[model samples]
Target: MSKGPVLLTGSAGFIGFHTARRLLARGETVIGVDNLNSYYDPALKQARLERLQAEPGYIHHTLDLADRPGMTAVFAGHAPRRIVHLGAQAGVRYSLEHPESYVDSNVVGFLTVLEGARAVQAEHLVFASTSSAFGANGALPFSVRQGVAHPMTVYAATKIANEAMAHSYSHLFGFPSTGLRFFTVYGPWGRPDMALFKFTRAILEGRPIDVYGHGEMERDFTYVDDIVDGVIAALDRPAAADPDWDAAMPDPSTSGVAPWRILNLGAGRREQLMRYIAVLEEALGMKAELNLMPVQDGDVARTEADVTETRAALGYAPSTSIEVGVKRFVDWYRDFYGV
Candidate 1:
């Protein structure tokens, strides 16, 4: 028998848009969902949706994940057995300004998703987490094995809640779930709120760009294509209870009681913020008027992900360099915006 359609939330966002395209290319039926909120430019989201609409095996619904009845009806109607729950109000700084938004979308919306998965007894569910969950940790490379008890922002906190909620459902419902903690993902069709897009736009417009942490920050900066690869790989391989999981020495990445796990999806290399800006300048052939300042509230100075488990489990290999990724983004931005 054929597989049911993959219920993919946030299908209009950056990572979601890319993941949808990849899935469609592989001849998989995709049920795309997105609220297309005005958190950022809705035009970008619409533009992405237009592209997906042109492809075969793609179905889209304009709905919010927090709508419990709406999501339940979708599950009952389509009965998707594999779900990629990527929809969430994403942004650390925005979460500070609108903490309630995070609770509604990331927390409440996630509950609806969990309920839907339980209703369908989903074979596997993969959801997006973030590296910011490691806030206040001074570790060089963030690992899923490490304890993430110090999330500095409401956004990260909600993601941690999602992980816990997914684990409980997996344990209770006898389904599998996986959470991917994505590092600073970038590339073409990226969010305007992200550093890369903001810097690129400002440089082209001859506007000053904020240099947080006095340009001393670092980021793993995984490309969007690499992120899609990791997401699909994790989606294909359902999680299973780790036999070696001991109560006395529990591994945070896996659970003995549930078929649930978390993995870090990143490039496994740290690039300084200054170096990143310099690359942007080179790509756009324009120097940015830097407005140096201290790190903003709910901001971390650096982030790197240890992808050892991701590699061993999924054969994940991130081959994009900062230089190449930035160049690709610049090319796409210019073509898309006619800049």
Candidate 2:
């Protein structure tokens, strides 16, 4: 049998770009796909893609996930052994303005990926979910076992739907699917739309930064490298059906009949919002003009991921502190933007 390609969708997006760069750095054969939409700045995505092209043994395919037939064609042509589905409409507040964007990209796009996996009979499929799925649970240290039925935004709801969709596919078709619930991932080459990038830019530009919930919030705030480590580890070990799964207990995190599981990829610690902003201030040597406001719709009070299961299953240990991550991010921001 010919060696199957390793496919990575969202190859130009923040997380996907970083993951692709890491894999290529290790002399891995990778086939990357992306639409390169103008959600923030396609120029940034293009720059990342250019960097990837410099790496040897890397192939590129430009396509949108909503293009069902185009997606199928890419899968059939490459026949990847493993798939990373990371492309999606990402943002909590923006989801309100563009609900259909979440539906088309996160929901419909995910279905296309699942279909591709089944068509190629891919051994493993790993995709990105979000901590926002926790919604108003207000629970400290959110675990994989927590109930995620209460999504506050269309984005979170779509991610929750993805987990359920993966479970159904795994159960019915015996797919080895792993869903990673990432919590507040940040670092270099990050999305301009994310909080870190926005806050950093605002602080440096001497503009007012919105401090939602009156600075009364905490987030797991995981670093991007840690998230990638968890994802790569999951790829090494495909999700397997839980033999000890009990129907009486009905665990929401695992499946007894399907080779499917959800893992929380995070730093396993929570920090207050203003504390995170303070780190940015320290790193950038500038202070943010604060616009403290009441909590907006689809906003959560706090998000803390319990990564015990991730550590146990994938040997995942998040070592990047927010202080370190914020510094790294600011350094990259200034260098990339030439500020």
Candidate 1 C-alpha lDDT tens digits along 1-339? 238899999999999999999999999999999999999999999999999999989999999999999999899999999999899999989987799999999999999999999999899999999999888988888989999899999999999999999999999998999999999999999999999999999989989999999999999999999999999999999999999999899999999999999999999999999999999999998899999999999999999999999999899999999999999999999999999
**Candidate 1 residue spans exceeding 4 A from truth:** none
Tens-digit lDDT track of model 2 for 203-248: 8888899888999988889999999999888988899999999999
Q: Which stretches of candidate 2 lie over 4 Å from their true place?
A: 1-3
Candidate lDDT scores, in order, read 0.95, 0.90
Cα error, residue 99 of model 2, in Å, equals: 0.7
Which residue pairs come into collision in candidate 2? Answer: none
Model 2 global lDDT (CA atoms, 0 to 1): 0.90
